[model samples]
Target: MPDGAPADTVTQLRRDLAAAYRLIAHFGMDDGIYTHISARLPDGPGGEKRFLLNPYGLRFDEVTAANLVTVDETGAVVDDPYGAGVNAAGFTIHSAVHMARHDAVCVLHTHTVAGVAVSSIKEGLLPLNQWSAQFFNRIAFHDYEGIALNLEERERIVADLGEKQVMLLRNHGTLLLGRSVAEAVKLALNLERSCKAQVAALGMGQTPIVLPDDVAEHTAGQYQKMYDKMEGAGGKDPEWDAFLRMLETAAPGYKG
Candidate 1:
């Protein structure tokens, strides 16, 4: 385990969450020091809910396992060796899902250009291709309600999210929920790519060929079945493993 952290599950959670930040930056999905990717930590000995959040002022590329902040459900920093404060907006959004959706171990929010562009569209994410079809009928939408800083907005956010794994904060950006940090990263990557494709296709000024409803739903089912198989087999995600290997070379020191 990294220094200054308990030698237990939290250690691994920190590394995985930090790796996610690094990977998001490496893939150009990060928006400077804005946006947030959070992972719920195991309850403390006293059973208080806690989460791992990137420090508010640090760029995703600068986040390391040892520097990530640990906060309670109320957004107060419980552990901050570096004294890096958590973002209020991050707490508002992440806490909403974490409190309501016990299955969402990791919640990733992004403000990528493609994601924002797609979020502004009326149709939301169109099933323009295989990448886009993966979320067909599976994604949710929450209308933008200014910046997510008010605690009262949490209820509506959860209501809009329902049980969906992916959501587009209309006029804002994208939100993804995963059973683990790895799963969250995979979802964010695919979602970003899907948005990019949609933006490009729509910009071509030609009528885009959208997949039939049946075909789109069938494709989504295939993707979900594969994911369910992986989860049932003990959550060993191959794509996440591959990304960790890439990180070993591409953006080392996230585990520091």
Candidate 2:
């Protein structure tokens, strides 16, 4: 098994994850303490299937680097020493995505006002603009089944998501799964923007001209390619990694 990287590299990852928490909170993506965002740790030699997740009952705004729970696939706290625990719903939701979609190393779930508003709408998000067009033909819808605490829900959840990276949980919120932290965050950002656009457009009392299937497929293709390009270009991810640095300045002790 690879001994992983140096302590400095590991520390930077914690900060990046923390920064993501703050960024999501800044964007109002966090619904009190209801939703969750998680990242799968790199699976190297000697590594158990592990992940970093928000501590159970911690508000997003209150999250700290030290507080993030490191757990195995079964939601067991294998390495959390700072007393923070993983959110069970986060496990129930993210574990299914990770298992079914090997490419989804990150999963972001949000219950923002606009997202829920659009999800509750009969037509979910429509192709009202370029931003909304990003999800054009790439969105899935899952009906709400109360809080996601039941382990039995995993099968149905993955089935609902099938081959889609974006899902609109009716009466719940939206979820974005991706191959990396940045990709997942970008998807969530766009998904929120799409939901906001949908709610606002509907509120304007104007009929939305949904895009043609061909156009939607093309747009989704463009987006998928853009991510591929970013991956292929070999750029550094310190920006996200540096987020933890900011959190240390703002809210430390999550590392404790």
Task: Give the per-residue lDDT digits (tens) of candidate 2, residues 19-48.
Answer: 667778867788887777877776646756
- After the best TM-score superposition of candidate 2, give how far the Cα of residue 154 lies from its true spot, in angstroms: 0.3
lDDT of 1: 0.90
Q: What TM-score, computed on C-alpha atoms, does each candidate reach?
A: 0.95, 0.85
Give a tens-digit lDDT track for model 1, residues 30-63: 9988998988887877778888888889999999
lDDT of each: 0.90, 0.77
Query: Following a full C-alpha superposition, what root-mean-square deviation does model 2 have from the true structure?
Result: 3.2
